[model samples]
Target chain A: MDLFYLAISSTFVNNILLAQYLGHCPFLGVSKRIGTALGMAAAIIFVTILSAIFTWSTFTYVLRPYGLEFLQTLTFILIIASLVQLVEIILKKKSKALYNALGVYLALITTNCAVMGVALLITRKELGFIEMLVFAIASSVGYALALLLFAGHRERLQISAIPKSMQGTAIALVTAGIMSLAFIGFRGMAA
Target chain B: MSKTQHIGATLKAGLWQRIPPFRLVLGLCPSLAITTSAENGLGMGLALAFVVTLSNGIISSLRNVIPGKVRIASYIVIIATLVSIVEIVMKAFFFPLSEQLGIYIPLIVVNCIVLGRAEGFASKNPPLISMADGISIGVGYTLSLTLIGSIRELLGSGSWFGLRVFGESFEPLAFLILAPGAFITIGILLGLQNLFSRWRGEKFIQS
Candidate 1:
């Protein structure tokens, strides 16, 4: 039940994209086309979960045992950067199809705060391995769900007549705002 | 132009030409996440200013030493180290604000604005101009966040920086402080920024 609550809570009630506001750049940047949005979503889920696991283990086994908590930010970022590079190289060598789909976004993932945010969040919450995995998966799923939904809106928005000043990100953001408002309706479910 | 004048021009450009969160559309996370209240916005902005400025200076100073192939990684390491310093300092000195900011303080390492400035301006420029660029951009971001925060605070709670800005008869718009409000507020602000640039007869700067 606790794990269930964690999943629902992260997925809906406390959505990383809508509520917590992590990864807004891609949320706004790549949500233009449904195809790219889907690709970005898949890449985000894959990398977010992987980086979360790596950072969690590093913190638990390495940072915590020592008095190097101050180095947490530095270490986690390096881990994530190198990990993203490593993933990209291995994916390119092993699976061309998968790499081609996720390759472009892999570079962008290094700077995506959502990956880094989840890593830090897991450490801060100190969830066990299982709980941490659940939370990471749930949060990234939440991110993907938001991205897809917003992409659908943006696709239609492409045809809609928008104000001259509100043509691009401005309109997309307002759309995201309304979506966020709708997500707030789920606040009581997990709680 | 003279050297000092050229540096001044760079600083000025950072303020208006490449102003962040609006012009650059960079650093959206903290700009949207923590700007619920004026004080929080101000605190976050100042913290970001400190990080971006220091990182820009450091990156500029070492631009030649970092190889092009590994520059991005080197920049991240330098930025992450600086962010750690900011996190520790905030934790030690401003406990409540740091607590409020939570993971964002650490997440500053990934903030595109910091890295963006490092790559775009700092790597090509000298340390003095880069630092100035950092200060101007940081100040611009600070102002934008504060404006967003002030509007939200005033509307949501009838207060500005914890001081009541509206009379007792004024009913607050509670939605402005909620998750949706952050997005809507920034969305509208970005629109206004577009309109302002248009009025100035300048092309809109796409992020």
Candidate 2:
């Protein structure tokens, strides 16, 4: 029940993209197509879960023990970066289908702040291993959910004529504003 | 090349030509989250400047030793270290501001601007040039943040930096400081920038 609540809140109430503003770059940049968004979502889900566990355990065992909590930022980032690369290589060797699905996105996930944010949040919230894993999955799902909606909107936008001045990010951002407003309805469910 | 000209070019490029928010659209996650008020924006900007400047200088100095494959990791580590220092300093001195900025301080480790500069400018340039690039981009980011923050704060609070400008008759539109407000403000600013470019007969900045 605790893990379920955590997952639900992370997905809806405190969405990393709309509510928390963690991964705007990729959310905006890659959400132009449903195909790309789904791919990115799959890769992010994979990476976020693994790194959340990896960083949480490392923090609990090594950094916290040695009073090197200050190194959390440095160590966690390095871990995420390396982990993304490792996942790519291992996927390529083990499962061709999975690697092909996540190929480009696995590389792109290196700088995706949502992955790093998951690690940081897991530590900040002081969740147990199971809860942390659930939260990571939920956050990725939340991000993926938001991305799908935006990608659908952007896809529709391709056919609709927009003012030249508001063509690119301006229009996208305004849409994000509306999406943000919509997400606020989830606040009643907030913890 | 002349020293003065090189420094001037870096500053100009960073401040106006390739400003992070409007121009390059880098480091925007931080901008969106922290620009609730001018004060928070300024505080976050200062923390970013301190981190970006030091990290850029250090990365530039160590560029030669870092191998090709692991350079990105190294840059992030150096940036995270500097961000940690700034986090501690901010907590020690400006407790309230630190509280307001919250998780963003440590998240600076992944801020694209810091890593962007380290990889793009610092890794290739000398320490002096990289330091200059850092300061210039920092100033550009600070000005943009304060600008966005002030607009949101004015609309949301009917005051400038906590000073009431309207004589109590102002019922502030509360949405201006909310999550939507951040996007609205930046969106309007970006649109205006595009309109200005079109008016000036310049190439439209691609988002």
Candidate 3:
């Protein structure tokens, strides 16, 4: 039940994009089309979970035992970079369709910060291995949820009449504001 | 638009022509997340300035030595190292502000502005020029963040740097410091900028 609350709170109330602002690059970059949104979300979900797992163990076993906690930033970044490369190579060899769908986004994930944010947040909260996994999954799910909803609105927004000046980032930000307002409503529901 | 552009133009471009967080639309994450108060925004901006200038200088010097395919990785390694240094320094010297900023400080490793400078300017230029690019862009980022921070601080808390600008009975919106408030604040500022540019008959709002 505690794990369930953690999942719900992170997914809804503490959304990575709308609430925490961890993954704004991906949130705004590939969110124009629904297809691209799904692709980006899928890639983030996959990599965020894996990077969390790897960074956690590395910090716990390697860094902590050796008193290298100061190396957290450098070590976690290197871990995330290698993990992204590994995921890219494996996806290409095993699943052509998935690889094609992910495309440039896979490479971009290495710098997405959501991956690193998950790892860092995990360390900050000092969650156990299982709790870390739960947070990662929930964070990514929240990213997907917000992306899909924004993509849907953006699809309609593409056709709708917006002012000339507010065409791209300006309007997207306003939409995000409204979406964030909605997400705030979920605060009392779970946590 | 010459092959060998003047150094002044590059610096000018980052300052006003293509200022970030507003014009280039890069680094919005920290711009929004940290700008709740002027102090936090200024702190974040200076940290970025240190990281960006140092990494750009290092990357520019090593551009030829780094292989083409691994350049991105190399750039990130350099950036992460600088960020780690800043993180440690802040922890030691500026513990209060460091605690205020939290993970966002370390997350600068992946900040678009830093990497954007690397791929866009630093990789091709000499170290001297790239260092200028970093400082120019860093100053632009600092000013923009400070502007946003002061606005949010004054309105959200009815104070500037906690001085309480407004009278005691004044009701602060309070929303201006929240997550939704951040988006609204930046969005309105972007629109207003574009609107002013259009009034002046200039092409603006690149993306």
Better of 2 and 3 by DockQ: 3
Ranking by TM-score: 1, 3, 2
Question: On lDDT, who's better, 2 or 3?
Answer: 3
Look at candidate 2 and tell me the lDDT of residue B15: 79
Q: What is the lDDT of residue A179 in candidate 3?
A: 95
TM-score of chain B of 1: 0.96
In Å, candidate 2's interface RMSD is: 1.2
lDDT of 3 by residue, B37-121 (tens): 9999899999998898999999999999999999998998899889989999999999999999999999999999999999999
Query: What DockQ do you compute for every candidate structure?
Result: 0.81, 0.74, 0.81
Clash tally, candidates in order = 0, 0, 0
Count of clashes in candidate 1: 0
User: Taking the tens digit of each residue's C-alpha lDDT, what string does model 2 give over A1-191?
Assistant: 87778888999989899989988888888888899888988888888889998999999999999999878887888888889888888888999998997768888787888888888878888988888888999999998899899999999877889988888888899899899999989888768
Cα TM-score per model: 0.98, 0.96, 0.97
In model 1, the runs with Cα more than 4 Å from the true position are B205-207
Interface RMSD of each: 1.2, 1.2, 1.0
